[model samples]
Target chain A: MVEQHIASAFDRDLEAIQAQIMKMGGLVEAAIMDAARALETRDEELAQQVRQGDKAIDGLEELINEEAARVIAIRAPAAVDLRLVLSVMKISGNLERIGDYAKNIAKRTAVLAQGPNVSESAAAMRRMAREVELMLKDALDSYIQRDVELAQDVIARDRDVDQMYNALFREFLTFMMEDPRNITPCMHLHFIAKNVERMGDHVTSIAEQVVYLVTGDKPEDDRQKADTTSSVPQEV
Target chain B: MVEQHIASAFDRDLEAIQAQIMKMGGLVEAAIMDAARALETRDEELAQQVRQGDKAIDGLEELINEEAARVIAIRAPAAVDLRLVLSVMKISGNLERIGDYAKNIAKRTAVLAQGPNVSESAAAMRRMAREVELMLKDALDSYIQRDVELAQDVIARDRDVDQMYNALFREFLTFMMEDPRNITPCMHLHFIAKNVERMGDHVTSIAEQVVYLVTGDKPEDDRQKADTTSSVPQEV
Candidate 1:
């Protein structure tokens, strides 16, 4: 009976730690959306919100690290638990980096907002952002539920994001070449596309982390094959 | 006496691991230099040589990872020893990624060899490549020697690499716009510049790992501030 209680207590702590990760994920997901939305609507206030959330993400990372250390110190978790904590640590770093990228996008977006949005490319950019936002959401869901198939689907979708970003980049280049006046805002838009592409990468990182959580193999090798061999169509 | 023997063995293993890291660092440093030289001279065979070294880098990373795991399982080291192993595991990944970037630059450089040198921005690009190569060498030295000042210097120098890349990028964009024939090679050159920039980033990552090895506290944030605030000029 005592052993059962101890096991149950350990389970509870693991669940709590997982819950904290989910909370941070939720906040970061929102930050990505809000950051992009700020860019689209020129809402500096929303960009401010995204910047403010960065510290919370940092605090959540600290909490997760400390709690994982305590669990390892106290419970001496075995293989599966050990893998889970390790995945959480690695995935949390990716998430924090995604947050930083979101902040970077917002800062540049704010500067871009000062200009006229007369170009036709902004509409295509909005569509690209929406798709990236959905991918981020689904990737986080897959992580929380440990859904390998969903994670794979997220990986498959990254090609679409990459293609869209490339097209948008080409179009932006054309716009910039037409007039030097378009250079500054066009560069901001270019970075926004790059950030969204990078955000997709972070989601892919999360997907890979989920795979590692399920299986011990690193996903790095598999990704190269998918990148080189897959024939997925562009979405945006 | 028993404690003395175990401590001595532990120290020996650490020295062995450090030696291996240094060995791997030498190869990566050489690959960086050769890749840049190949680009400067358009030497396809030398580029291929850099590409071949990537496999050796992979082997080294695998060896280091296995050694780290074995040490953890057998000796169950604690405190500073554990931190050193952890830092090595992380930094080994950084070094391997740097190797991959060198391979990438070589691949792009190889393609550019078939064509005439980009007439407009080749000088700026050559300068950028040299600066990046030196930064990689200095960063590796910092890691092997645990020279904090040297690491700081590497970080500060990254700003120069970035500035050069930015200038090259703008110049290349103009070339691409002026002549559609230049687009393919210019894009390849752009990727080469980006690869070198990324190499500088990996060096900084290694520097961070070294700082963590020496100080125990995560020095990433402080290093970022010092690199930007101390010596590097701020640019708009």
Candidate 2:
């Protein structure tokens, strides 16, 4: 009976922290979506909301870390249980980074507002950001359900984001080559594109962590990178 | 006496991981320097070496992680010891990221090789890389010695790196505006500079981890950002 009591208590503690992680992930997903929407629609207010929302995301990361630390201190969990807590911490850290990139996009959205409209580039970025946000959602679901297939699916989707980024990168180069006046706004748009692409990378990392949490080992195959094109100008 | 023996065993386990963390840090520092040197001197061989050295850095992260995991499983460490182990893992993650950024710089150096030589900008980026490498070394030292002052110093230096990046961002814009031919190489150099600045951010994060490990509390003040200036063209 005593052993059962301790096990239940620890399980409860783990569940509580897991709930907070999902909450943090939800906020991050919203931030990504909202940042993309603001960029696509040029909605300053929505961009501002994304920026303001990051404080909450940052707060959740701190709370999750504290809760995980508390669990380690008190529960002294064994191997799998400990990996659960550690992976939560790692996932939350990655979520916080994704949130920061979203905020970066929002910030650039405001600046790009002052310059000429790169509507086509904004549309491409919005698509990439949407893909990342969905991947993050699936990654969280995989964690909650211990579904390795879902996690693997999220990992596979990162390649699509990379291909989108490369296409947009080439397009931006062409825009700059044609018109020097397109330089500044194109630069801002490119940075936002890179930020979204990086956010996708972090989401992939979180998905990999989920697979590790379930399987007790990292994935055998390394992450496949589809980004071979360089910053080199294809035509001068 | 029996309890003390177990405690000493945990300490030795931690010491072993800490040593590996420092070793990873050293390799990362070397990668940063060599990448910068390769850029400045246009030495393809040295740049390629930096790329190859990343494998060793990645291997160390895996080793440090496995050792830390072994200790946590066997020892079930208490609050302080557990925090020490977790912090080492975090430090190693940050070190690996720094190594990756160095690899990115090296990769870009190769791309820039095929384009025109931007010696002035390479010199500037080299300076930024040097600052980040020094900060990373001190961060590792602070972790070993538990020196809060040194860690804080490292954190403070990140602003200078940001300023350098902003300066380069502007210079790259000017170059692109002056001659269309400079566009491709300047873009690559700017990306390399951004990567070095990001490496400094990771180094600062490692410093923050050291402060938390020693003081048992994260630094209350958030990291200051000095990279407010954007790639926006001035006065059109």
Candidate 3:
């Protein structure tokens, strides 16, 4: 009876921290959508909301860290339990970075609001952001379900985001070469695109952690990346 | 007597893992300096060595991780012990990333080898890389000694690296504008300098982890970063 009671209490602590992480993920997911929508529609108010809202995400990270630390201190969990706590902390850190990237996209979107709308390319970026947002959702779901396949699926989607980013990189270069006026705005847009690409990487990492948790092995070496920036398409 | 023996065994485990982290740090430091020297001297052979040497650094990370997992599993460490294990894992991850950045710098230097010499900026970049190498050294020392102030000092040095990068950014822009022929090489140099700047960031992150491990508190809000790429300095 004593052993069973101690086990239950320890589990309750893990459940509570996991709940915190899910809550944090919800906020990050919302930020991703909001940032992308603001970019797509040039919504300054929405962009402002994302920038202001990141503080709450940052605050949740501190809380999750504290809870995880406290659980480690008091529970003195064995290998499996320690892995759970450590991974939750790591996933939360990744979510926080993803949120920062969302905020960065919003900042650039605001800069882009005043200038000409690179509407065609902006829409392409929006699609890229959507793909990453879905990946994050799947990554969090896999964590909750302990579903390795779902996590692997999320990891694989990252390549699509990378390909989209490379396409956008080529397009941006052409835009700048076509018009000197496009240089400043296109640079801003390119940086924003790069941030979105980086967010995909963090989500992929989160998924990789999920795989590591479910199975003792890391994800098979990620597919050879195709996002080499220097390999610009031929200018006929 | 039994309790004392267990405690000493735990200390041995901790010491063993710390030794591994220190060994990894040594390799990363050498990689950083070698990458910079290759860039300065335009030595493709030395660049190749940095690239090849990174595989050993990656191998060390896997070993450190496996050891950490084994300790957590078998020893069932208490909260303080768990913190030490987790922080060591985080430091190893940082060092791995620093190695990757060094390899990236080396790759770019190899590309620049075929182009006209941008010797002036390459020299400046070497100095910038030196600052980051020193910062990484201090960060690792602080980790080993558990010195929060030294860790904080390492964090502060990142701004200097960022400033150097911004100055180089301006210079690269000027070079490209002055001569269309200079565009390709300057772009390569710019990317290399950006890689060095990012290495400083990873070092800062490692120092932040050290501060957290020692004080149980992350460094209070890092000084506001001033590396806004658009803030091109106006000549007086």
User: How well does chain B match by TM-score in each candidate?
Assistant: 0.88, 0.96, 0.94
Task: Name the runs in model 1 displaced over 4 angstroms.
Answer: A1-13, A66-78, A176-184, A220-236, B1-6, B48-52, B114-116, B173-188, B220-236
Model 2 stretches with alpha carbons more than 4 Å out: A231-236, B231-236
* Model 1 TM-score (2 dp): 0.81
Candidate ranking under lDDT, highest first, comes to 2, 3, 1
User: lDDT per residue, candidate 1, B6-115, as tens digits?
Assistant: 87887888778878887888888888888888888889999999988888988898788668655554565666666676677777878888888888778777667777
Mind giving the per-residue lDDT tens digits that candidate 3 earns over B1-236?
Answer: 98888888989998999999999999999999999999899899999999899989999998998798777666767777878887888889889999988988887777777666854998999999999999999999999999989999998788899999988887876665565455556656777888899899889988999888888886665356756673332220
In Å, residue A96's CA in model 2 sits off its true spot by 0.8
The residue pairs that clash in candidate 3, if any, are: none
Stretches of candidate 3 off by over 4 Å are A114-119, A230-236, B75-80, B179-187, B230-236
Model 2: per-residue lDDT, tens digit, B1-236?
A: 98999999998888888888878888998999999999999888999999899989999998998798788778888778888888888889899998999988888777777666764888888889999988888988888999999999999999999999988988888888887777777777778888988898899988999889888877764566888755254234
Q: Score the docking of each candidate (DockQ).
A: 0.21, 0.48, 0.29
Clashing residue pairs, backbone N/CA/C < 3 A, model 1: none
Candidate 3 local lDDT, A83-158, one digit each (tens): 8887988899899899988987887777778777653888898899999999999999999999999999998898
The models' CA-based lDDT, in order, is 0.72, 0.86, 0.83
Sort by TM-score, best first.
Answer: 2, 3, 1
Instruction: Please state the CAPRI-style docking class of candidate 3.
Output: acceptable
